[model samples]
Target chain A: MEDVRLLMLPGPVPLPERVLQAMMRQAINHRGPEFGAAYTESVEVLKTCFGTENEVFILSGSGTAGMDAAISNFGKGKKIASLVNGKFGDRLYEIASRNGDATGIASEWGTPVDLAALEEALENGAEMVTMVHNETSAGILNPAKEVGRLARKHDALFVMDGVTSVGGDEVLADEWGVDVAIVGSQKCLAAPAGLAAVAVSDRAWDRIVEDRPYYLDLASYRKSAHKEPMQTPYTPAVPLFLGLHESLMMIKEEGMEARVARHHRMSASVRAAVAAWGLEMFPQLDEHSAYSNTVTAVRMPEGVADADVRGTVKKMGIEIAGGQDHLKGKIFRIGSMGAVSAPEILATLAAVQHALRKAGVAGVGDGVEAAAEVLNP
Target chain B: MEDVRLLMLPGPVPLPERVLQAMMRQAINHRGPEFGAAYTESVEVLKTCFGTENEVFILSGSGTAGMDAAISNFGKGKKIASLVNGKFGDRLYEIASRNGDATGIASEWGTPVDLAALEEALENGAEMVTMVHNETSAGILNPAKEVGRLARKHDALFVMDGVTSVGGDEVLADEWGVDVAIVGSQKCLAAPAGLAAVAVSDRAWDRIVEDRPYYLDLASYRKSAHKEPMQTPYTPAVPLFLGLHESLMMIKEEGMEARVARHHRMSASVRAAVAAWGLEMFPQLDEHSAYSNTVTAVRMPEGVADADVRGTVKKMGIEIAGGQDHLKGKIFRIGSMGAVSAPEILATLAAVQHALRKAGVAGVGDGVEAAAEVLNP
Candidate 1:
């Protein structure tokens, strides 16, 4: 059996062998100087990744686990508001609701957060407002800056789950007024999943110092940071942290601007190729267009089944996703997150064109060329 | 500046490069077949690591995070008995106390669990009992099998923390009549810390299936067991899993018997060398020792502090550990965990002898020859 080279559907995309080599180093004791240096440098790199001036810390769990830490830590039962537009948005509510006082401003799946609804929630004296900046489930990029401003106006902590957007899009945590921003290594950062990096403002930290789950306590982590290599209250997966450290260095080398531009170009190219194939994006056509630079969600063409499209891509050594909730079986989600630049995007678009033609879908002539122009631009 | 290598304390022995390579692989979506295949195989290897014939499952967080899954998942909230000897044993009580009703059978640190006391607890209609098979903090190994038999005699579940013992000791989950065996990758496994493997017997499964933390539910893991590669409930740390898969294969190739023999031999070598140097092996060592095959804790000389001993080892590029809790700065711990096997042990022992001599402990002499003789024997 041949080892399968992965086309990661959502994230952490494909990793370069160079980063894998760096991750292969031996695990250091978390309480050792070697680990301390690694942890400190890694946090510094995360600060770069988050584009935040506030201190950066990592949660030794999944992206959602960070959601628990962020909301449970800062909200402290002082009413919290969440934006719900996708599975991720629902997660914010579920985690916050379980921890303390929190409410979700509901929105339909596949739609971005209506800024108005969030504004209304914040106006009601919400202690914190949480939302997924890029809801991967629906492939919609919420206006995080707008949300952050609203949080500021209402004196609420602006907590954004930048799991999908941070590395691939513009995540100026400080400049954009995002009091707390979270990013998962598996997403745009392109590290393997397992580590979650979040930058919390001092205001947010003030609330975390109070009574909280001992295991997920951020206050304890704050004190332990730098003294040891990002020592968690619990034993972390050291290998993943090593991988994250290497991946962060790789991201810096690639240049954040370059990464952001590449994702935008890939999304634009994907749009062009889909347009040529007579398919439509799931987001409103040109209206309120804040599509994630990484993943493009598109509705199936008339007579085209979502399974058929996904199966075709799979057969051709390409992987695409399908709708998660209301749009399940109705749309195709193609990811351009992490390591998806000119060559990857073009190759995938070419494969998509071939797969669609094989599926009896027409009007995809010169799909590669159409995508190439936008991808390179 | 010299590139400093980390000296991992006994609990999270540093990882080797081979393990890190596996974690550096591309991050795949949790909902992908490629990952599914990897996840399923990891669980299978996990069963073998625990020497179990039952089932193996994985959690995506730290070893402690997985500990939460272990107790919270299988514990029935009924009367539970926890053998408390050291920090880790206390952790079992903490988990049991929070999620359900628990009775802690206290033992002084550095002393083994009194099976007679545990038997009394079990006989009192205790629904479950938890034990740390190897206590890293005090270098005590509770007789799990003896306690396991007691639990069986009273029809109570037997849960063992194999965190530092699994790959380092002869952990026969089934043969020992153990119901729940919790293992971590870092300690003796030579893999990085983060991934934890748990084996559940039919008896424990009944409890786990009845009520468990939703995220840590053993039933959900069981449902996904037969699903290709392996499918975890949440976004798994892909690179680490991949690395762990590779590490397990390496362990399998070595064969379980040979691996256990290696750990036992290493333990014997370290003990013989420590005794040869006239160093005390903790307060009045047990005739039937509770010492872990992975790590050996020794009492520092009457006047020479453990902290002083550890500092010298750090300077020599070898890492040693100090005692925890009440024993802090009184005892020094040296590990024989995998990756840093015979060669590393011999080197560390030599360094320890040097550190002791420097501390004005004149009983110290060359331990390399002594350790080497034990290794050959």
Candidate 2:
């Protein structure tokens, strides 16, 4: 790597200097007043980032922590429908089952989870349905709004994983009828990676109260939200939350729609340029690809190794990811993550094409010219 | 608060500048090689700070997180006896009952959790007994060695909360026969809060593997720990862990025994001054009156408001805690947490005397001089 600060790859994307400063600022007493002010304000910002009016609880863990809390509290004694089409989708299903909720779903890599099948599964009277808004594993964005609507119609709680979608996509937690939503500081939020957040609707809140484990419980966290300064039931990751506060403000300043649009613009250009290079688009359903502008997973041509492509491109400080699990070596993922611009995308595509040619892949033609045309056009 | 960059209420004690800088170091990819280095080194430091030869697992939440994990993992499918004598001890009971396993026996606040009662309670097929080494709530130190032997004799897991004791007192986790010992980064440890640790012996590890709850499951963390550049199974308070690493190094430089002595010297001075001032200690047990080096709870003179005294001391930029729960209005808890010296203790005693007298309590002679003489003699 040419530079130590790698902005690419996956989560924990390069943070803004201000966010680092916030995390570096003197650590505060998680229970004290100063930290409470920062934590409480950070919660407010997280609520706005998720586009919800409900209380937000920031946990001092990764995105998985929020996912665990959501299902454990609300999914107790209730069936949960998990929509799995990727690695993180499996993660959702696993955590749900681990939390004592029953989960069985059908999904295939590189394809959006079948909503029709999910509806059929809901016949068993699931109390909640968990789905990843952006399935980072396969680089596919599920039809969340439609799935959420279906979940509501079935009277099941709709818990959405917005880990990869929150900052890069226009996610309206309230409008979409999402009862519980999970988000992380890494990914498109461009903050340090330790903090995870959740926004709960009244429906989910009721379930939380009815079945709450003291440690993972959200009822107390919600009640304590308004009354006290943000004292975590435990000592929290104080510095990460402060950095999250700054990141949310930056997101708000850009306006959520504007931020999402910027991502769309870059993702579109990358898709267009990659197509011109004759690489197959891995996301099966094309028109339905309203993906979070953060990442795009593409199928590698026959004999062009995913590792070779990622390795060579990384040499130019443009890090990319290879598919995980079954899809590994079959596909590559390039991110239009935080601060990725038109020029950067154009440069990255050129670098990828060069790498493919270096690996002895034939039919690599005028990739830079195509990227330049996509950028200017 | 005057032109200070940060104001910590004594601790989540004041974080050293170097500690803050270290914590701010960019977040390393948890699965990456670099994180393995950090994880391994941190575990070593944690062992040193905890005064144990066993492997230490760093949980992401607060000190209570460790308590909950300890109780859940150690006493799975069995009952646990808990010696409750303070606010924190009550927390141990709550965590014991929070989920998975464990039953507890608790005593009233300001008492030594009656080791005799605990011994009897262990016979009810309780598999583990949890106790707080330093009850921050009532400012009393439970006889940990005695409790350890009592629990081990009964073949019960001996778990202790060292949140307020580690740096201030000798917590020989191994020598004391503690199967699972928990500690936080605040109070006597003299570090910023958020990180909590648990040292596990071979016996405890077997229990952790046998009964696991996924998230609080320390075995998975240990597996990932063995893999290089320190990695946590989940996202942790990255910055706080960095601060903790630095703070651990500092504790070593001071030498653990000397640090322990410093706390005792300060404790002796506080007790002598209280006696000279004719103020009674909160603990009813005499030997318990020896006190924790970090804190002491003193009964307010009849009719003197604990809040009033604490509020006045806080105005002078020295914040002290009022008794929690029922003890709220009855007594004042003065703490000598983190890097506290004998002179600082003398200054605080002087301030306490002034605050007490101003709140309409008549004191016996010069309190500061009395404290100094107690230390010198």
Q: Which ten residues in a row have the lowest lDDT in candidate 2 chain A?
A: A1-10
lDDT of 2 by residue, A149-197 (tens): 9898889999899988887777889988999998988878888776778
- For A101-162, candidate 1 gives per-residue lDDT tens digits of 78889877766677787788777778888888888777788877777788888888888999
How does model 1 fare in lDDT? 0.76
**Candidate number achieving the greatest DockQ relative to the actual structure:** 1
Global Cα lDDT for candidate 2 = 0.75
Candidate 1 global TM-score: 0.90
TM-score versus the correct structure, for each prediction: 0.90, 0.92
Q: Give the root-mean-square deviation of each candidate in angstroms.
A: 3.4, 3.0
- Is model 2 an incorrect, acceptable, medium or high docking prediction? acceptable
Top-scoring candidate (TM-score): 2
